[model samples]
Target: MPDAYFLPDYRTIRYCLMKHILHGFTLIEMAVVLVILAFLLGSLLMPMSEQMKQQKIRNTQQRLAELKETLIGFAIDKGRLPCPASTTNGLETAGCGDNTEGYFPWRTLSLNIRQDAWGHPF
Candidate 1:
């Protein structure tokens, strides 16, 4: 008197316990919806990472004001101001007199990026 093929009656154990309690989330509600979607994707990526670090510090202050107006238009077309580079081949340096610092000749101002905006140099 208890063998409906094997024995699962009472309306199939109350419809398999109401289809496993409505069949859904419950590992603490999917870990509280994955911790509220990782706290809403970390508050929307923290102001887009501080607006990409203030657009890389305003693109390194507009590339140091276009390299100080290309070194004042190469000292008004080469009347003076060149020499600086030569940390072993960035050019320039025929004579910065008593070595007035160095680096930034950008190949004697023909320009082509020596580095900046985080890479350093320049």
Candidate 2:
């Protein structure tokens, strides 16, 4: 009797088991938290996306204006508009001022932006 181990009684063991089993949040609570996090992230990100779109629009507009000024400068110097580049490639596909009508001579004028932000030729 002096060497016997002191085991916990059944009532205490049951109480400990129940406490461990009920310790954490339920599955529904976790789901609700995840839903709330998703809503917060979505709301935070939406305005940023719109601002990015607006910035792109502003950039395209600036590029277009610069392109106009460059063309005017070229006309003043050369006495005629530069030839249109090929639609397929960005650079001037033919000789300069050969058929300078349809497209902007971006390559001939040393301009880098061959197309607008929307991927259409300037």
What is every candidate's alpha-carbon RMSD to the true fold?
Answer: 8.7, 6.1
**Which lDDT values do the candidates have, in the order given?**
0.80, 0.78
**Worst 10 contiguous positions by lDDT, candidate 1:** 1-10
Query: How well does each candidate superpose onto the true structure, as a TM-score?
Result: 0.43, 0.65
On a 0 to 100 scale, what is the lDDT of residue 53 in model 2?
A: 87
Over the full model, what C-alpha lDDT does candidate 1 score relative to the true structure?
A: 0.80
Task: Please tell me which predicted candidate would have the highest lDDT against the true structure.
Answer: 1
Backbone clashes in each candidate structure, one number apiece? 0, 1
Pairs clashing in candidate 2? 83-100
User: 75, model 1: CA deviation in Å?
Assistant: 0.6
TM-score winner among the candidates?
2
Residue by residue across 19-109, what tens digits does model 1's lDDT show? 8876653666888899999999999999999998899788888888888999898889877788787693578877578648878888767
